[model samples]
Target: MLLVIGPGAVGTVLAGYLSAAGRSVRLLCPESALPALSAADEIVIDRVTGGPPLRAPKPLLTTTVNPERVTQIFICVKQPDLESVCDLIPPALPPSVPLVSMLNAPSAVHRLRERFPQHTALPASVLFNAQLLEPFRARVTTVPRIQLPFEHRQVVESFAGTGIRPVRAFGEASAWGKLLLNLSNAIAAVTHSTFRDILSNPLLRASYADLLDEAIRVLRAARIPFRAPLPVSLSAYQMMMRHAGALPWWLARWKWRLAEGAYPSMVSDIAHGRPTEADALNGEIVRVAARAGVDAPLNAKMVTLVEQVGAQRPPRYLSPAELRSALGHHLQT
Candidate 1:
């Protein structure tokens, strides 16, 4: 049996879809969420790319994880919630059951390894975003996919026909590479712009470029490998961020395709008065830059901005120009 922890957007979508694919699955949600999810008895995945909505059979929803029956565990939670959530599960879970960390934080697997010292906590990068429009419905703008370490190949059989592809790669490198794109999530959250707005608008793209470049520079200085999340090379993806304005629409059409009413997950958290994962995503760059004896002020500033917004409800959203200014002198006036 597959035990998917959390009934947040990612958890519900994955557990629901896997169950739809005829896999044995269960959803471990917070105590407060149990009632609503239990009442729904299923989740609806509305695909922005078009087609009928996917109705995922409700997997067994519960507040507690029965380690005895769980064959594998997929942890789908924000970075700030990691330790607290892990504390809810029994430490006696079988050592053979791999703990898949499908988190935006690049270092989540390392953190998971620390917490579950005896278990194999494999790192996975969620290559798609699913937004929870309501209690039991998630919207997928992009085709849902996940990137896993080569070591995760053993569990690939569990994903068979689940509509979620498990692409194998060097986990650490892929996580960092994905972080480069995720930096924009904080940008969208702070500016109150849709993910599409960040890429489509020149000023927003420039601000995003500034953040990406800063993180990229820090990684290069530290000699950290930046393997592409997909088959494309890091240089190619960077080019898309840095010079997207000069390129034709076709050159960047894929970006638009995947972003439908898409704001970063942090946007929702901020809107609803919850913590964001700015620390795990942008904060990783700041920590690495410190270790490497480099400056990552832009990423650091973003971490502050995201935290502030989440703390103060009804945030006064920053305009693109203001955000670019906050980032520093990287843009023209």
Candidate 2:
């Protein structure tokens, strides 16, 4: 059985997909989330295949159950909620039941591994960008793709056909690769733009490239092997920025059309007055850079901007130029 904790966009996406795949998936959420979810039977994914909308019936299990019955538990909560969520997992869960965390940062894996020493703790990174449109409806801007670098092959295999395929990362190298990609979330969020937006803008694109470079440096300093995929790679991304003017007009327009529906998680946090994973996303970069004796001014500035915006007395939008100015020192250099 799959127990998906925190019925937010990520959790809902997994629940909807797995349930549609005929898996015994159960959604465990707080009382507050029930009202928004109780009345809906479908999750709308606008990013994957236009807007036909994906539906998952009331397969949601609201009541708490014995943890032992939960063979696999997917912790889909935000980074800040990790400790609190971990506390909620009953100790009675069988020692063999593996706990998979779909958190973005590298720190979450180490922390969860320490907290759930009795159970098999695996760190799984999700690649899709999901947004909750309403209580029960969510739009998946990206396909549901995930890579888990845990040592347990069997545990990863169990989720093979459930729309969340786990990729094996023999050691810490794979985890680092996931972390490198996650750095883009903050850039996309701070700009109040989609991934395509950030990638399209020459300045924003350069900012992203520099951020990844900083991340790569930090990983190398820590002796962690970090590799990025094509398009997202440091060199390839820089080339894209340099040749920004050469893209076909039609291709650029199509990219924007696709990104128009994409909603960033940090932007959602700001809109809803909820604390975001700034600490995990950008703050993680700062922490690691400091440890490695390197300065990650771009990420550090983004962390500050996100926190300040999130805490403002009267919420206001931080313009792209203003945000770019904030990171001027790093960018100008």
Candidate 3:
């Protein structure tokens, strides 16, 4: 049996996928989600790319883990909740249960490994966007795929004939590659802009470019192998950024294909008054930059902005220009 912890966007969508593929799955959610989870007989997945809604038979939901039946565990909580999730694992499951980290933080894999030194914690990346529109309903904007490090071929075979795609990564390189695209999530959270709007605005794109460039510099200085998350190469992405007008067209029509209606996870987190994964996203860059003796001013500023917004009861959405000016003001300080 597969135990998927957390009923948020990532957990719910993945539970749907596995259950639809005929796997025996269970969802372990917080007490807050019990009412919604109990009410829904099935999980509704609204595909944004023009497909009939997918209704998967909802799996059993509980607040506690049954270590006896759970053969494998997937930690799908937001970054802020990760440490708590880590603490929940050791006593609940046997040390050998294969654990997969699906959170967006590039450093999450390492953190999980450190936390559970005895377990086989595999690093994986989710290259899709899922939003929890309701307690039991989710909107998935991208076709879901899991990228696993090459060392986990046995785990890869577990998904055989399940329609779930798993790509073998080149070590930690895949996580860093995915981080390039995730840098924009903080932007969306702060600006309340859809993916299209963020890409379309010249100033916003410039800010995003700075964030990406800063991450690349930190990665280079740290001697970490990095790849472009988009279909194009890093060089091609740099070339595209040089021409602002071309950037949005590429993002909307080719690269991202993210629907205008899609909201990033952090955006939804702030909207729901849940803690945002600012540390996992921009804060990771700031940490790496600090260790490398490099200044990631844009990411640093974003980290501050996201933390401040996350603390609000009703998070105020900053305008794109406002976010841009804030970052600019910090750079000048």
Candidate 4:
């Protein structure tokens, strides 16, 4: 049996896919998530790129974990929820079950491993774009694929017919690659902009490009392997960064299609009055850079912006220009 924790877009959508693949799955969520979840035994899976909608039905639902019955576990909660969930997770899983995490940052797996030393923890980079339209309804706003830690053929084959594709990776390279792309997550949240808007705007694009570049520098200085999981290569990515404000036509067009119907997770967190993962995403870059004796002023500035905005009772609003000015001051300092 497959066990999924959390009821966010990723977890909710994953449970539907596993059920569609003929796997016995149980989704464990909090009491607040039950009303909408129990409304129906099936979830609507809409394919935005190009496909008909399908229903994944009858996934077992529960609020508690049954360790013995669970064969595998997938952790799909946001980073801010990690600490609170950590204590409740370790005791519920047997040592033999492989724990797959779809968190944004690679360092999250290390924390999970420390908490659940008896189990095998693997970091899976989520490449799909999904949005929650309603309490129980979620849809794939873009393509769906996941980069797993290693080439486990059986694991890869299990998702063969399903729409969600799985790719095998090595040495945590995929996680770092995904992290580079996700540097914009906080930017999207902070500016209250859509994904396309974030990339299309010169200021937002330039800010994100610099943040990604800083992360790459830190990783290189730390002697960590960095790879681009996207179709682009390392040199090509660096070249693209150079012309950050003026993006290639093809890339910009491709991004809009995927981003049109989606919003960043942190944005959703802001909307629902939940804590955002600013610290885990951009903050992770700052932490890693400090350890490598490098200063990432751009990312450090973003972390502060997110914290300030997130603390406001009514989410603090900041224009892109204001954000750029804030970043500029840090760069000058």
Candidate 5:
């Protein structure tokens, strides 16, 4: 049995996939989302990655956690919700049930390990793009994959033949690598663009290239083991970044089939006036650079921009040019 906390996109993605794979799953969500969730008879697993949407019939949905029957737990909420959700976990959770954190940042699982010293806490980097279309619907825009801390067959095999595979190539390294790639998450939120737009637009592409260049330089200076975040290598992405503003004729595109609802988590957060993980995603890069006696002003800039935008009642908006200008002389090559 699996108890997935937070019925957001990622959480719903996990439930839908696991439930399809014949695993018993329960979703724990906030009370506010319950009404809309209850309206839907089943969780909708919509795919933009070349497939028809599938329905995963009712798994138990609750506002509270029932740990007694839960044989496994997946923490799918963002960093801000971590503490409150941690309090909901049964104090006597058996050591066998791993508290697997599928949060965006690698630091989340580190905090989980600190919170429950005796319990087994693991970080699993979510290597997929999913957007929450509704309270009970999640759209996967990419083929979903997970990077487990190690080859935990019990967890890996559960998703087998279910479209979500646990590829154990780089593990922790891939988690950090994913963080570096996610520096663009804030760009989507601040610019009011779809996650696809960030990479599709030449200006947005160049802006993110500037940010990624800054992060990579610092990570190398700190001697962190940089590896592939997605299935492709980091070097491959960096090469793409090099041709950031190139047209279709100048380069080969991945040709991602994105849905209209395909937006980043931060984009969704700002739209709904909820808090985002900008601090965790971009802020993590800033902290790492600071500890290494370097300044990650670009990443620091994103953290502040996301905060400023999200703090607005209507959510502050910026165009790609305005956003790039806001980054000021830092992005001027």
Candidate 6:
């Protein structure tokens, strides 16, 4: 049995897919909100690519649980709530029950590994983007994809039949690869635009490239082997940034198609006046760079701007000129 904790976008989408695929799934949500979703399926996934939508059968929702019944558990809560959620789960769970973390921040993996040493823990990175639009309804802007960086290949293989294809990562290198892609999430959230829009804007594109370049430098300094896959190579991306204005229309469209959709989780949070995972995404880069004695002014400034935006302060939109001014001499070539 698969246990999906937290009924947010990530958890609901996973539950809907797995349950629709004939897997027994249970949703564990907070008690206060349980009654509101008692009769609901708890998950509705609308595939953006015109694929058939998936709706989970009536979910088994409960606040408390006997973890022994859960053969596998997916932690889907936000980074800030991870520790509290983990603490709520009964300690009776068997030592063998694998706990997979589908979070954007890589630091959560390390924290969970340390806190739950007795249980088999697998640190996973989710590749898909989804949004919870309404009660039990999840708009899946991208297909469900996950990359698991763990030593147990069989554990990942076990998920093959469940539609959640798990890519096996040989080592921590895969973790860094996932983190590299996450750079765009914070960028999209701050700009309040789609991936297409974010990439289309030359200035925004450069800012994103600066963030990724700094991230790569930090990873390299930490002795982590992280590299982007073919066609999407880090070097190629940087080169594209240099000639973004010169790229042919068709070619640029092709590239956007390959890139993931604008991050819906961030969009939903921003629209609803909730705090975003900026600290987990770009802020994490700033924190790591500080420890490595590396400079990441672009990422730092972006983080500051995002935090300010999330605070509901004035100047909601930063114009290109404003962004240039904020970036200062860095924009001067």
Each model's Cα RMSD: 2.3, 3.1, 2.2, 2.2, 2.5, 3.0
Best by TM-score: 1
lDDT of all predictions? 0.80, 0.70, 0.79, 0.77, 0.79, 0.70
Please report the TM-score between candidate 2 and the true structure.
Answer: 0.87
lDDT of 4 by residue, 1-333 (tens): 888888888987888788888878899888887887888757777777666776888587788778779887788988877776676664857788877888888888999889888888888888887887775578887678878764555455656777687777765877888888888888888888877767667787777777877888888988788676766776676667567554633474475347463667788877667888888878888888889898888888888888888788788867888887888777633
lDDT of 6 at 102: 80
Q: Per-residue lDDT for 111 in model 3?
A: 85
- On residues 122-172, what C-alpha lDDT tens digit does candidate 5 reach at each position? 778887788887877878876677877556776666677877877784656
Q: In candidate 6, what are the lDDT values of residues 76-156, reduced to their tens digit?
A: 988888888778767788888887878777787788778888987776777667777665788776546677754676457
Query: Would you list the rank order by TM-score, best first?
Result: 1, 4, 3, 5, 6, 2
Off by over 4 Å in 1: 246-256, 329-333
At residue 201, give the lDDT of candidate 1: 82
lDDT of 3 by residue, 1-333 (tens): 888989988898888878887888999887877987898879888876666877889998877778889888888988878787877774657887888888887677788888878888876888778888787689888666688776666567656665457877766788888888789889988887777766777877777877888788888998888765567678777556657564655565554456767767788777778777777888888888889888788888898888888787788888878887888875634
Residue 26's lDDT in candidate 6: 85
How far is 85's C-alpha from truth in model 4 (Å)?
A: 2.7
C-alpha-based local distance difference test score of model 1: 0.80
Q: What is the lDDT of residue 249 in candidate 5?
A: 15
Give a tens-digit lDDT track for model 2, residues 1-333: 888887888888888777877878888888777776777756554456465667666556664746756888888889888888888788788888878888877677788789878887777777667887776577776556677654676666656776555555545556667677667677766656666666666666667667777777777786676655333455665566556543422243353233444656887787667888877877877788788887777788878877777777555666667766677777635
Give me the runs in candidate 2 sitting further than 4 Å from their true place: 42-47, 63-65, 150-153, 163-170, 231-233, 242-259, 331-333
Best by lDDT: 1
Candidate 6 wrong stretches, greater than 4 Å: 39-42, 150-154, 229-231, 244-261, 313-315, 329-333
TM-score list, all predictions: 0.93, 0.87, 0.92, 0.92, 0.91, 0.88
